[model samples]
Target chain A: MTDASLNTASTQTGEAGFGDYFALLKPRVMTLVVFTALVGLLAAPVSVHPVVGFAAILFIAVGGGASGALNMWWDADIDAVMKRTARRPIPSGKVTGDEAFAIGMTLSAFAVVFLALATNWVAAGLLAFTIFFYVVIYSMWLKRWTPQNIVIGGAAGAFPPMIGWAAATGTVSIESVLMFALIFMWTPPHFWALALFMRSDYDEAGVPMLTVTHGRRATRVHILVYTILLAALAIGTGFTAVGGPIYLAVAVVLNVMFLIGAVRIWRRDEVMSEADNYAVEKKVFRLSLYYLFAHFGAIALEAGLAPFGFGGW
Target chain B: MSFRQEHELHKRRFGRNLGLGVILAGLVALVFGLTVVKVSNDDFSVETQASGGQN
Candidate 1:
């Protein structure tokens, strides 16, 4: 490398600062976690005390931030290698890897302990496990070793709503499981779509993405399969206790459109991929964003209707 | 006071506002109040007071 020295910038050049450390938490992703977790708390059958609910969500957000920090800590090497990720907090010398690790561990402990104190032990335990799953299992293990990293690692992001539910209700339920299932199903297609267009990213980063490990053709098919399954699961959730006619109807229409998009991707030619560049892949990525917001919005709507006693399966 | 005291006061003015707690609480209350008001106007005459159920 001539592009930029891959050495830790924090020590050599001293780029690490307050903002850089904050950025390591991936606040954009944390915003999504907070919003979804709030929806889960609102939709839950149980009502947590206001302070308790606030504390639970706050701790959950911190846990999410902790995961992001640990992810940066571990992926520093790859971040230095990849163009898109070259300027990340750790790789750009904006933050030291050791500092990131320390921050992640501290936040992780604080989140789990405070969540347990504010909510219930069960929710706290789940939050702890979620952090471990993301930092230890996904960042440390699956991400470098296998192409299915996103598939399994996606579990970390999926647990927020379930934890929010448990925080409210003190236990797991079919509805929470379904919420988990919806996010779990969406992860594969969402990330694979990015991988398809950004294949060179994985090549340069040396990340074993499905597109890199198995070829773009295989990754495209897998995205289609997972999208279909996600659609099915999304629609099925509407029939559950947490769902209602509104959610069901919305799920059906959204899933149908999602499936159509997946099929379009699958049928396209790879030779054509180089020509169209990011069109198809970008479409898939944009659709995946809509897919998540729509599902959660429908859930929130169903809950809104419930106060009227006019919505349910 | 030493230089650190003056600097701390100046920084607090510019650093991330710590008053978000009340702001967030106010927002939540506004939304909850709006929901109650909307429901009251609607036909939800089930006398649903405060929540006390499980899913």
Candidate 2:
């Protein structure tokens, strides 16, 4: 082989490995799936055996990973240009696109079928839709075509717990739908806040994000609007069988703090936003991560106490 | 539209695509076999504590 050919082979071999394959799964997002699916399993009115529940969460996590892998595969080109995602499995050549695509497509089918076998058809169907939504709807279609990508695409991540709920109950309920809505509503604000700080990333990559398409000021305003809606939905979660005074208190405090941050961002100048300073934007971004976790954490708390009649029924 | 690196964009020949289909089908079958084995041996009716929030 010529020197250039040998080098290409070396780069491909070096890039594709077990770790890279695993990275394609996006473990951080998978963690959210596990937690939310667990909560859904716990929150359901019906009960599942411990072993079955464990299996359910496992398959759901696999499904989430499958979605991530497919997303990485499809977005590899865009990801290579974006600094934040430049090191991803496909982008780095650590995983061959065909391998990543194969893994993703394979896992999607596996997870959906197993979820159905282990639990019910409803849960399996939800998993199937979630995968399709993320890959076909969010990644392929919505991403390049519009700025509303994150708003609608976020629903893919929101379905796990509902899938878990259906696994246990074999049906959908207001509770499950609300859980889905909580994430769906929370996603735009959560992602838009990050988009504000990383506006340049979207611009250079030409992903047509809200900030890139509408500018930072518009993105901030949208973030605040979505944050308002998200905060309201979060606090509202406290009123159902999932809520109590403790959960209510947590929501009020978190939402208030979140609102203050959104307002602060709204007031900041583009110069200030683009600066290296992390005080305001950093807080908002970090809070966005914890915000969803805290909400779910409170839900878990309510469920744990509900059986004892400690928290509200 | 663009390949991240040389290998990621290797055009899948018919043989490669067929191989992928077989591998994916095998994985589904394997997982299904394990699931059926477990279900037959273990009681699925056993219930435990429900998990999260008001619902």
Where does candidate 1 stray beyond 4 Å? A1-15, B1-55
What interface RMSD does every candidate have?
Answer: 9.2, 7.4
All DockQ scores: 0.05, 0.05
- Candidate 2 ranges with C-alpha deviation above 4 Å: A1-11, A275-278, B1-55
Interface RMSD (Å) of candidate 2? 7.4
lDDT of 1 by residue, A169-268 (tens): 8898888888888888899999998888877778877789998889888988998999888887888788888888888888888888888888888998
* Candidate 2 C-alpha lDDT tens digits along B1-55: 6655545434333345665577579657756665665666534323222322324
Docking class of 1: incorrect
Which residue pairs in model 1 clash with each other? A9-A93, A16-A94
lDDT of residue A48 for candidate 1: 61
Give lDDT: candidate 1, residue A174: 87
